[model samples]
Target chain A: MVQEDYILEAEKLYVSYNEIDIVRNVNFRIRKGEFLGIVGESGSGKTTLLRALMMLKRKNNDIKGNVRFQGRELIGLDEESLRRLRGMEISMIPQNAVTAMDGTKTISSLFHETICMHRDGKIRRRDSDKLASQIMEKMRLEDTGRILKAYPFELSGGMCQRVMIAAAMINNPKLMLGDEPTSALDVTSQLQVIQELELLKSNYQVSMIMISHNLGVISRIADTIAIMYGGRFVEYGSHEDIIRHAVHPYTKALLAAVPDADGKISKGLPGLPPTFEKEMKGCPFASRCEYCIPRCRKELPEDVAISLTHRVQCFRTKELQDDIA
Target chain B: MTLLKVENLTKRFKKNGETVTAVNEISFSVEAGECLGIVGESGCGKSTAANLISRLQREDEGNIFFEGRKINGGFRLKPVGRELQMIFQNPQDSFDPRDTVLQGIMQGALSYKVYSNRELKEKALDLFSYVGLKPEYQNKKTSELSGGECQRAAVARALICEPKLLICDEATSALDVLVQAQLIDLLKKLKNDKKMAMIFITHDLPLAAAFCDRIAVMHKGRIIEIGEARKVLKSPEQEETKKLIQAVLPVR
Candidate 1:
């Protein structure tokens, strides 16, 4: 696809704290209406990467890279200019809904504030409420009247999330960033949330970037899968390329570790996840990788395209692929 | 081979002055060295049932038998808590905030008087290895440990008593997939190697299918369907069972 066709594009993106880069040299491009799923465990810097995309870095961290949204550069944009892009153009659904929304305020007020922020005095409370309920109904949330009146804590975890998703749609954002959107839900509720997201993708021309620890969740939702480990994209490919033909040891190990629907389980990837305490070199997964050699520990491997879209960063990916085949 | 059996077990609580039948006439038997999974949504009385079985909360009605001995307020002989231990969903509440994880584990075993204080420390360390925790983590407080690490320590604490029957009340649900996988592998080992029986309670049917020998689907504080895990997964008898099996996002 051409550069203008991409909804969000990142080049050599780095989010650093105390001169220690947490998210290092990240690069990805999402075309319009495409979903990019980032799979990572906790501390993999997936959240940091998402925050950096919108100039929402923590007070101590500095985001260094080039990120273009609809051909408009995001980095170094003043807070006033960035505000215009955020919420209306680029929306986000946070990990925890209850914490993100005001607990004391009813769901309607939260929606009113969000809608009013982007539209200024051009929009009123009634219009925003109508828009919110319309989106909620589209998401198949019943009892809109009761839901709008209910406090954030009064709603269930899944309901709160659905409300957030609905609220995010009020401004009609081109890009939606979800961080572990359905992780807190039970199985049935999770299914509902996933279905709603799928519906949103089909019904609306919106591109999404969701980072979740659940491979199953990502596999079902995303068009492209990025397997992130130690703050780097260890593997990036189309859903088929990553799922059917996984090459990276971390990706394969991650795929193998979880219990399948049949209840089959692997020995699980051993060792604690890497703690990025200092500036270091080599693969982040080398310590836990079963096929790790001495060279693997000392040298950081660059991304090699095993296929047109499937990229892997591992010294032993070739041998691993051979063994798997 | 019946390890623990519950006959018409019922528990009730007054919520806002309204009586709630948390567990209504539940009956089941767990075999020695068997893992029986109780699957249900939140507030379906799975956790309440676990609490009653472990004697954390007394059942309102029905009988509980541990190794064929009827257990009640005056029950003796087997002493439920020692032989029948439980791991909760959040290990944060399971341990002492001030003490080391090793100290918390030793505390569980110290009451039984089977091991010396010095010997219990060594046993705790051994259990840590089994749970994939490093030896150095023994001194760290529960606050210092990660959620997975705290959970592993909780497993060690439960194992310190060397319980025959372990009731995990959505114990792995709070953890991420990789940690859950590792924890399940460790639990499976304990079940096989020590002939331990477990009552695995979780809302996820697919997860239960992976570990449990028998699966029981619960709805409205009652077991709607109970059968072999394979049978329940392949061909569920009840509508509730079908809903649960259908709800899981297809991975394969």
Candidate 2:
């Protein structure tokens, strides 16, 4: 696809804090109205990538490489220009809605802020109120008036999450970034939230980059899947390609970890992920990988293209393929 | 025979002068050596019930019986507290920062005067091993361990008390899927070795179904349904339970 066909693209991006590279040489692209899922464990730099995209990281943090939106480099954008782009061109629905939103502010006021900011200070109270109600209605939120009047603390977690989504999508941004959107919710509420996201993606024609640890959620919604580990993408491809034929050991471990509906427990991977402070000389997963070779422990694996779309960073990719064959 | 029975257990907290019934007249029972799972959403009173059983919180009005003796009927039962212990969700907060894993477990054993100092150390090391932690981890502080290690330490502390009942309140919820599977395996091993009865409280129905012999489904502080884990989860009798089951994505 041409560059213009993609709404967002990250090319060889590197993000670091205090000179420590947290996200190393990441690359991905999100097409128009496509849902991309980034799955990884905690401290895997998934959040860091999203923060970099939103420009929400600390000012002193060093960001290297290119992040383009509609072919425009976003790394050098000024605060004013970035602010103008936010909620109009792109918006983020943060995790932990209870803390992300102001506890004292009503849901309606939060929606008003987004509308006002995105409209370049042109939104009126009457128009904002109508828009908020319409959006809330689209979300199928109950008692819209009461919800608008109630503060974040007054609503349930599920309700607060919906309100956050409404606020984020009120201006109808072209792309939406969700950071562990359903992780904080219960199973039932998680399904509802995922359904709402599907609805928004379809109705609003908005592309999404959903970051989650649950592969099950990714399987349900994501068109593309990127498995991140130790600040790098170990595998990236279509959902079918990655799920059916995961080339990376970390991705295989993740898939095995999920309990089947029959309640049969699978063998879990042993050992913990290496700490970020430790310098990785080879494959980050080599220590815990069952198929680790001596070469895997000493040499970093390069990203090897397997097919037109599938790619993986593993020395044993061919061996795994042959074993499957 | 019922190993433990909860009769109309209720707890209320006054927040801003409004009485919120956290546990609303919920009742359930567990057989000896049975693992009973309590599944619900947050603010649905599963944790409250666990706390009540562990004596971490006193219920407003209810009766909890263990071994045919009443334990939650307004009468003080310090002995019952010794027979039950709780494992919280956040393992780091459950332990003191300055305390090592051995120190934490030894403290639990020492509280009931179960073992001498040297014996406690040995027991702590053994507990660590039982939970799949290395003996070297016994001297490590909470900060030195990962989330899964910290949870193993928490389990060691709870088990060191040698309680007849263990209450795991979302003990594996904060863990990654792989770590969660390991912890569940550890719990299953411990249950088989000790034949210990447990109350596994969580919001994940599938997890509960996997770990518990029976499950109690809670909604709005009420025990909406209770039965064998497979039956209750597979063919829930209550509307709320059915909705919860349907909401979960079917695992492939």
Candidate 3:
């Protein structure tokens, strides 16, 4: 495939907060209209990785990355230049719709402001009304007139999330970044959000990088899944590789921890994730990894390619696979 | 023996000048040392029903019989504090921000005046270990602990009173999947070793099906489905329950 075929590519991406490295040497290539789901426990830096991809700013944040979006380098871009890409070329949906949205503003004005930001000028209220309702219809949020007039507090959390999705889609960006977009929702609303995302995939051909702690949701929706442990992708593979042919012990343990759809929970991983209080040297999962050998604690293994799309960062990958097979 | 029995339990709140029947005449009985899971969405009256049973909120109309003694609106005459305890969903926020988890638990236990200072400390330490926390965490503030650890602390706090009937309202909802699994294992062990009855309330249908002996699903302030976990999973009676079961997409 040509280089242009890839929508976004990352090379040796590293991010640290206040001199403490959180994301390290992450590399991946996402093709057009393909979504990658990143899963991890809290403090695993999944959210940090998403923000670094978009160059979102925070106190004492540092990013050293080579990100190619449509073959254009994005790491060194000026703020003004990056602003053009955001919400137009790349959109982000936040974790909490209720908190992310301004409670004082009406939904109509919120949409109007989002449009006005990327368009570089003021937009007519009538045009915002038309555009907001049109995309809201696509998102399956009926009663547009009422919803448009109501504040964020008035609408339910699910409705606010769908409205946020609609606002993100207003410019028809090529890619979307979501941070647990459906985590705060109930099952019904979560299914609805999934349906909306599926619609976007089919209708608009939008690619996404979504962060979720839910294994079930990620496995169901994501084309390629990346399992993050202690700020790095311990295992990045296709659904078949990670779920069926899992090589990393942490990935396997994460799967075992979740109760199945029929509600049968198996043996659990005993210890908690590494707090990273000591000097970083070996695999972050070494503390809790049941099959951890002496070498796993001494050194961090390279990301070994088990297949064309699957990568496992563990010294015992082959042995684990052989045992499973 | 029947540990708890609710007959015609109802709670209504006037929200925005409109009367909302949060829990509408829901009735169920829990046996001693058995887990009863109540599954529902937000505003489905599961939490309200729990509050009514735990005496956190007064029921508009109902009869709550605790161990065959009617104790609703009459909790003062027949105090069930030592026997009945409830844990909320957000244990982190439920705790006092300034106090350590050990202090909070100790204070709650102190309300009963059952144990002396030295025995209370020992029992708190014992309960802390029982809930799967290390001894050092006893002095740590609630803010320093993770969500799962804080919830375990909440469990320790609740168990300090030695409540035979424990009500956990969405206790594991805020944690990660792996953490939720660990907490589930802890709860199962507690049920057996401590001989405790639990009203495990959550919105997770499959979890309830797996964890509880009997499952009661509430919808729109009503009990839509109530039966054995296996029976409910095999053949659900209500459309709402069926939708909930279907809503859980299996992880491949």
Q: Which prediction has the highest DockQ against the true structure? A: 3
Better of 1 and 3 by TM-score: 3
Residues A202-313 of candidate 1: C-alpha lDDT, one tens digit per residue: 9998999999888888999889999998889999999999889898888877787666767677876777778776767788898888788999888988988898888898
lDDT of 3 by residue, B1-252 (tens): 999999989999999999999999999999999999999877799998988888888889989999998888744523788789888889888888888878877765778888998888889888887888888887789999999999988888888888889999999888888888889989999887988999999887888877899999999999988999878876899999988877766688
Off by over 4 Å in 3: B74-78
Q: For model 2, which pairs clash?
A: none
For model 1 chain B, give the 10-residue run with minimal summed lDDT: B72-81
Per-model DockQ: 0.63, 0.60, 0.66
Candidate 3: CAPRI quality band: medium
Worst 10 residues of 3 chain A by lDDT: A270-279
- Candidate 2: which docking quality band? medium
Model 2, A167-204: lDDT tens per residue? Answer: 88888899999999888888888888888998987888
Candidate 3 lDDT over residue span A1-325, tens digit each: 4989989999999898888888888989899899899999988999999998899979999999799899989988999999999999999999899899998899999999999999878889999999999999987788999999999999888888988999999989999999999888878778888888888888888999999998888888899999998888999988888888888888877887666766787655677887654369788898887788999899988899988999989999888888988
lDDT at residue B43 of model 3 (Cα atoms)? 76
